[model samples]
Target: MSDQPVHIIANFTVQDAAKYREYEKGFFPILKKHGGEFITFDDSSVTFEGTAPPQGRVVIFKFPTEDAATSWYNDPDYQSLSEHRRAGTTLNFLTMVHSLPPRN
Candidate 1:
């Protein structure tokens, strides 16, 4: 966290609605195991905007340290579930960003 925050942006392909929901069941638990938090989700309906549906799913989680982020990404449980996510959808781009430290 570095007294700031780590930001992540992941855009993905979700063709089946039911499968996506099922993936969540596996995902949310793994994330919680790694101390992850659910900040914002696409509300299961991306059509809220003209952007379109199945634009992909987005998630936001915070960690107190970069290592925690690394751990979460590399955890075995997540690794197993990640295979499902990868098989089910296409992840266009996933990024990790850390905010600039605040001025004293």
Candidate 2:
């Protein structure tokens, strides 16, 4: 795996609480399986610069490398679990950001 770290930033609006909870319950194990870590999530975030803050929640998670993040996203088990999320929420964005190179 590459040394570079990657982060997934998911912004979504929950439409069905029960189904979203089911997706949340199943997320961690799949994340761990692919060497990913849950960073944080914000439901009440403010946007200082943007015209409007995100509609709902913003979730952040990290992986040791980009490949690991992609693997987790593409995993069949995770995909199955993601169906719950899809059914329960409207995702505005699920972006992957690469960490900057370490300072020399």
Candidate 3:
């Protein structure tokens, strides 16, 4: 694993809670399989200054390394389960960001 962690940020609106729930139930196992860890999730986020703040649910997660994060995203099981999310929600954005290096 690299010293730098990778973070996944997702913003979405659930259209079908039941189907989305199914996706949620299956997400964690695949994430852990590839060294990913859940960070936090917020259904309501207050934006202090941004012109465009994320609407609906915002989720954040981290992985030991970028490779681990990417692998988890592309894993076959995850892809299969993602269908439920796709079918049940409007995904605004899903992005990966690398952690900043430590400052001297």
Best by TM-score: 2
Best-fitting candidate, scored by lDDT: 2
Candidate 1 ranges with C-alpha deviation above 4 Å:
1-4, 43-54
Residue 104 in candidate 1, Cα distance off native in Å: 0.6
Write down the lDDT of every candidate, Cα atoms only: 0.69, 0.94, 0.92
* Winner by TM-score between candidate 3 and candidate 2: 2
Q: Report the C-alpha lDDT of model 2 over 1-104, residue by residue, as the tens digit.
A: 56799999999999999999999999999999999999999998788886864579999999999999999999999999999999999999999999998999
Q: What is the overall TM-score of model 1 with all chains considered together?
A: 0.73
Candidate 1 C-alpha error for residue 9, in Å: 1.6
Model 1 C-alpha lDDT per residue in residues 14-73, reported as the tens digit of each score: 766565666778987776776667678663544454655345677666665566677888
After superposition, which runs of candidate 2 have C-alpha atoms over 4 Å from their true positions?
A: none
| Model 1 whole-model lDDT (C-alpha atoms) | 0.69
The stretch of ten residues in a row with the least summed lDDT in candidate 1 is 45-54
Residue 54 lDDT, candidate 1, scale 0-100: 48
Clashing pairs in 1: 1-64
* Residue-pair clashes per candidate: 1, 0, 0
Ranking by TM-score: 2, 3, 1
Q: lDDT: which is higher, 2 or 3?
A: 2
Q: Write the per-residue lDDT of candidate 3 for residues 1-104, one digit (tens) a residue.
A: 55799899999999999999999999999999999999999999888885765478999999988889989989999999999999999999999998987799
